[model samples]
Every structure is written in structure tokens, then in C-alpha cells.
Target: MIITKAKPIEEILPFLEGKERIFLVGCNVCAAKMKTGGEPEVLALFDYLTGLDYNVIGWAVPTAACSVRSYESLVEKNEKLKEADCVLVMACGSGTSVIASILDLPVTGTNDTLSLGGQIGSSAINHLCSLCGDCNIGDYSGICPNACCPKSQINGPCGGSKNGMCEVSKTSECVWYIIEKRMKTVQTLPILNKIKPPKDHFV
Candidate 1:
């Protein structure tokens, strides 16, 4: 899933400075899960903007704000959108870009795209993939040092690691340590014998 966080109100306020008719768009998937751009959030923003004397024509919490089909569906049915001079998108940067591309009016986002992550039970795990063209996650039992490690240490941990924690940050568990533990658990310790080469950044 794509992780997202709300932008400060101060930043969003500037985008609405002179806009009168406003149409708000929210994401129902990732942003909804994160409580950033859910239906509740859209309604809250709608009321807040209405209280400020702005005419909020309409709002929609699309199934996925990133989909062109979603916005097309909205445009087909929501006549209120046609009256708006600008759109406020409560979703990730990708969603904002999609809206901007489809709409002729000015479009702005309320959320900042954080990272690609997944849910581990109730916990949200981030930095799972760096999106490097070259993937060698299979070698480390599905752990990618390029993304999990602050230093991007592929072969092993830096000498500064202590107590299974990264030297760069006391709060972070050393990725190499996690990789070693995972390798041992799967009886693939011999895989560690093979050295990994430097990452090809050009890819």
C-alpha cells in the first residue's frame, strides 16, 4: 500500500485563497485506511470550508483517487464539479497528479505521499521497496537492504551496529541483523558467503 500523511492546513490554505466554488475529492483506499482522505475527512473539510464562507459545491470519496475511470465517473454524474473553479484532492501525490491531468481547472493535493508500505497486523511497515530496477530481495530472504538499511548496506551491517540496532538510529533495528536472523531461520546461512556487488544506480 502507499502510505500518505496530511499536509499542514497552512500549506493548503494558500491554494484556496481566491477560489470560490470548491470541489473536494478524497481517496477511499490507502488514504482512507490512513485516515487522511476518507469520507469522514472530506466531510470535515467540507464543513470547515463552508464555515469559512467558501462555497463547497460538492465532494466525492472515489474508490481510488488515482484511477482516471473514477474521476470520469464523477464528471459524468456530478454536475456540481462543473461549477467549481478548482479542486482540492485529499489523496497521495499520484492521485493529485491524476486529477490535475484530467481536469482543466487548478488542482491541489492535501496529502503528501510518504512511501510504499504494508500492514503487519495492526502495524504499518514502511521502506519495504526502494523501486530499484534491479531486485535482489530473494537473496536475503525477501529483505531488501537497499530500502530497509539507512546506509543501503547490501552485504552486511556497518561496523557501528550494536545490540541488533542500527548505528545511524538507536530506534531502528539493523537490517543486516534482521537479514542474518531470517537467513538462519530458513537454514540459508550459506547464502551470506556470496558477496553482493555495488548497486547500479543507473538502472
Candidate 2:
């Protein structure tokens, strides 16, 4: 799932100014799971906009907002999508791009894309795999400190790791401790002790 956070209404309202007829598009996949761009969220935003005297033309919360073909099909079926002065996509940043690509209208994003999610728990999802396009999981004992750690230290933990929790985020577990514990259990502790050179990004 692609985790997302709702942009504050204050920021959204400013961008929406001077745009009378507005169309809303919400995602039913990742954004819906986060409760930021689902059907309920779209209707909630619709009601809010109606209260603010914004002429909302129409809205749609489809199953996949990132699919360009699906979006074009949706637009073909719903004339309101093309009739609106501006489109406010209630999904991730990529959903906005999908809408803009199909429609010639002024399209923009409502929710801010956060990260590729491993678990859907909080408004900000817990991330495990960053999809860095590099597979170094074996070296890190299947734990990615470089992705979860604020410091992004590939080698090991920094001085900030104390009491098995990260200094940056107290709720976050210390990644180095997790890696070492995992390595020891697998009898790969000796391999972990070996120093590694910098990652070759070209690879």
C-alpha cells in the first residue's frame, strides 16, 4: 500500500480559491485504506466544500485511481468529470498525475504521498521495504535500518540508538539491535562483523 497523509484544509482551501466548479476524485486502494481518499472521505470533503459555498460539480471514488485507462473510462461515463473547472484528487500524488493525463482540466492532489507501506496502522503507515531498487536484505539480516532509520546508516546504528529504541522516534525499535539479534540467531554473526564498503549505486 502507498501510505498517504491528508493535506490540511488550510492549504487546500488556498489552492481551491477562484475555482468554483470542482470535481473530486478519490482512490479506493491505498488512500482508502488510510481513510484519506475513500468514498467516505470524498463525501466528507464534498459536504465540507458545499458548506464553504464551493460549487462541486461531481465526485468519484473508484477502485483504482492510478489506472489511466480506468480513469479515462470513468471520465467517459461521467460528464461531470470533464465539466468541472478544477479537479481535486483525493488520492496519492500519482493519482493526480493519472487524472491530469486523461483530462485537460486543472488537476491537483489533496493528500500527500508518504511512503510504500508494510503495515496499515496509523495515519502515517509503518514502512518496512523502501523499494530502493537495491536488494540488500540478506546483508541486513532481512531488516532495513537504512529505510526505517532516520539516519539512513547502512553499516550500523549510530550513537542515538539507546535502550533498543531510536532517538529520532522513541516508538521505533533500534534497527541495529534487530539486525544483530537476527544475525546471531542465524549463525551469520561472523559475516555481519565484516566491514562493507559503500554501496555502488550504479549497480
Q: What do the candidate models score in CA lDDT, each in turn?
A: 0.89, 0.82
Clashing pairs in 2: none
Q: lDDT: which candidate is best?
A: 1
For residue 104, model 2's alpha carbon misses the true position, in angstroms, by 1.6
> Where in model 2 is the C-alpha error above 4 Å?
120-125, 185-188, 200-203
**Candidate 2 per-residue lDDT over residues 42-150, each given as its tens digit:** 9999999999899998999878788758545887767787678898998887877887888777888999887777553554545666677776778877777657778
Error of 2 at 166 (Å): 1.4
Backbone clashes under 3 angstroms, per model: 0, 0
Q: After superposition, how far is residue 160 of candidate 1 from its true place, in Å?
A: 3.2
Candidate 1 per-residue lDDT, tens place, 23-92, comes to: 9999999889888999999999999989988889999888888986744677886788988999999998
Model 1 residue 135 CA deviation in Å: 1.8
Residue pairs with colliding backbones in model 1 are none
Worst-scoring 10-residue span by lDDT in model 1: 68-77
Using all chains and alpha carbons, the TM-scores for the candidates as numbered come to: 0.90, 0.87
